[model samples]
Target: MSGKQDCKTRYPLLLAHGLGVTEHGGLYVPWGRVPDVLRAHGAEVCFGGQDAWGSIETGAAQLAEAVRKIRHLYGCERVNIIAHSKGGLEARHLISAMGYGKYVASLTMLSTPNRGSRVAELLLHARPGVAVWARGNDAWWRQGGDKHPDALRAGEQLTPAYLEIFNRTHPDACCVYYQSWGARLGKHNTDAAMRLTHGLFYPAHGDSDGLVTPQSARWGRYRGTLTGVSHQQLVDAQGVDSGGFDVRGFYVRLVQELVQMGF
Candidate 1:
C-alpha cells in the first residue's frame, strides 16, 4: 500500500527534527547514527525544513513544503517521514491539515510530545527569562507568532481542540501508518543540563526527557516503550560521550523495523 515506487527511490526518507534545533540536514541522533545504516541498506534521505521553535502549524507547513519539493525533485508522489519530539506533531499536521497524507508512505515519531508537555506549560508561566530568549530566535518567532502571549496561548493546553482536529483529519490516512516511541531520563546523570531544565520547567514529571513526559510522548497508538532511553539518547548514543542508557542497539532495531516495513 505504499505510494508510487519512483518517489520511494528518489526521496526514501524525510527526517524532521524537534524544536530549538537546526534543519541544515545534519544528522542529530538516532537519525544521525541510523540514517547511514538505512542508506547502506538502500535508502535516500531528505530534510523536512523545521522551525527553530515554531508552532505546530508553522512547522507542519514547512514540512509539507519540503515534501512537495522532494516530490518535485525526485519525480515521485510520496515520501516517508521520520520525526523526533515536536517534529512528530508537525509531521502529523502535514498529513492531516496540509493534505500531505496522499503523498506520504509512513510516519515514525520518536520521543515526541504528541499530547502536549507539562514542561512547555510550566515554561509558559514560570520562565519569563526563557520566553525572552525564545523571542530572539527566528524559528521561535515563526512558530510562535512574534508574541509571548500567542506562544503561551498556543501551548497552554494540548487541548481537545487541537487533538480533535488532528484526529479527525489524520485518523489513519490511506497507506500511511502512524507509529511512536518514547524514552525517560531515569536519573539526573543522564544529562545534567536536562535534569536542571526539567527541574525548572517540569518538576512534576520527574525523570522525564527534559522537555516531554513519557505519557505525552505516546501519540496515535500504543507501539512500545523503550525503557531507560533518554530523549536525546534515543537518537545516537554511540561514542559521542553522553550519559543515560545505551541506545545503539535501539537505533539499530528501529531502523531495521523501518526497513522491514518498507519505509
Candidate 2:
C-alpha cells in the first residue's frame, strides 16, 4: 500500500532538488525517501545534480548533463522531471533554453515560485544579515554547483523583475507539458519556522506554502493546494516519521497523474 506501483509513467522519473540543498549523502538527499518510494512503486528515478544556489543558467546546464546521463543509462529518449523550489526554475531553463525539451517528457513542479515570490524580493531589500548562515550553506551549495557565495543574488533572481525577463527569454517549450503542485501550513502555526515564513509571505502574496504563495506558484495545470502542509514538509521525508502529511502517498498521486497523461 505504501510503495505501490501507482506512478509507473512511460518515461523514468528525475527528481530535482531546491535551493540551499545539495544532492549528496544519506542525510543530504534532496527528495529524501521519495526516490526509494518511487523505485519501489516500479518507477525508475534519477536525481538532478544541479547546484543548490547557483545562477539559473548555471544550474540548468548541470541539469542538462544529468538528463543526458539518465537518458544514456535508461537507453530512453526522455525522462519525466519532478522539480521542487528553485530546481523547478532549472528544469524550465533546461527545457526552454538549453535544448533539453526533446529529452524531457513532462515537467511537474512542486511548490515552485514560477511567478516569483515577494519574500525573496523583500529579503534582498531588507539586507538582513544571513551572511554567517550563508557562509556555511554556500559550502554545500558550491559543491558541484556555482563558485561564489551568492545567497543574496539568488534571492534577486527569484523576484518578479528577474522571472518576468526569464519567462520572456525562456518561454515554455512547445513540445513539453508543464504542471505544478503547491501546499500551505494552516493559518494557525504548526511548525515554528514555517509559521515565520507564512506571516512574511501571506501578507504580501496571500495564502502560501510558507515561502511561496499560490499566486506565484501557479503554472500550467495547477494542482490544488495541500492544506496544512508547509514548504519544508512538502519535500522533507523526515516529516513522514514525524506523523506529518503522507509525503510518499502525496507523490504517489502526483506521479500517477503523469502516468495517466501517458508520460
Candidate 3:
C-alpha cells in the first residue's frame, strides 16, 4: 500500500534544482533516482529547466514558462513544485511575483535558504579581493547556462538584509500552499567538503547541510529537517554510496502527504 502506484495527486509534480546544477539535454535529473520513483508511484513529474546561476528574476521567468508547458503537455490545471535550495527562491518568486500562483497548487521546498545564508553575508562583507575572485567565478557560471551570472547579485539576494526586503515585496501567495524542508551536516559529517563548510557556518549558523543552514531554510509551513542528508546528497547519489536519507522514499511520503491533503 505504501509504495504502490496509487500515489497520484490532483495536480502534476515539478522538480526544480538548486544553483550550479543544470539539467542539460534532459539526460540527467537533479533529483537523481527520485523522479523515476515518484513516476512509478503514479506521479506525473516535470522539470523546471532554469539556468543554474541565473538571477532570481531570470529563474522565475523560466519557471513560468515551464509551468505553462506542464499545464499544456499534461492537460493539467495546476502543478505542485518540489524545489531545492536556490530553486526554491525562484519557485516562490514565480508564485508571488510572476502571478503564477493560480497555476501552482503547492510549493514544497527542500533545503532552501528562505531566511538567507550565513556565508552569503560573509562574502558580501569581505574585502575587495574576495569580490574580484567572485567575479572570476561568475564568469565560469556565465559560460555554463547563466547569461548573467553575477555572484554578487546572487550573494546579495541570499543575504539576510536582502531577503528581509524581498519578503516584504514578494509575500507568499494566498492561493499557493507553501512548505519547506531543511537538513543538517554537523562538524562530524561524512561529506568532506561539507565538514569544512560546517566549521565555517558554526560561528554564525551552527548546523547546515554544506551550503544552507537549518534556521535559514525554515520558511512557510516549516516541515522538519532531514536528519542525515547533506545539501549535495539530497540531489545527487554521489557515486554509489550515499548513506543518508532515502531520497526515493522521501518523495513518496511527500506526495502521499499531498494526496492526503487533497492537492
Ranking by lDDT: 3, 2, 1
Question: lDDT tens digits, residues 106-212, model 2?
Answer: 99888898889887887766565755556666776566555554666677789988989888898888889998888777755356777787786667766787788
Q: Which candidate should be chosen as best, given TM-score against the real structure?
A: 3
Ranking by TM-score: 3, 2, 1
Q: Give the distance in Å from residue 79's predicted Cα in candidate 2 to where it truly belongs.
A: 0.8
What would the per-residue lDDT of candidate 1 be over residues 33-61, giving only the tens digit for each residue? 55555555555778876655557787787
- Could you tell me how far off, in angstroms, the CA of residue 130 lies in candidate 3 after the best superposition? 4.0
**Clash count list over all predictions:** 5, 0, 0
Which has the better lDDT: candidate 1, or candidate 3? 3
Runs of candidate 2 with Cα error greater than 4 angstroms are: 1-4, 25-29, 128-149, 241-244
Model 2 TM = 0.88
Give me the overall lDDT of model 1.
Answer: 0.64
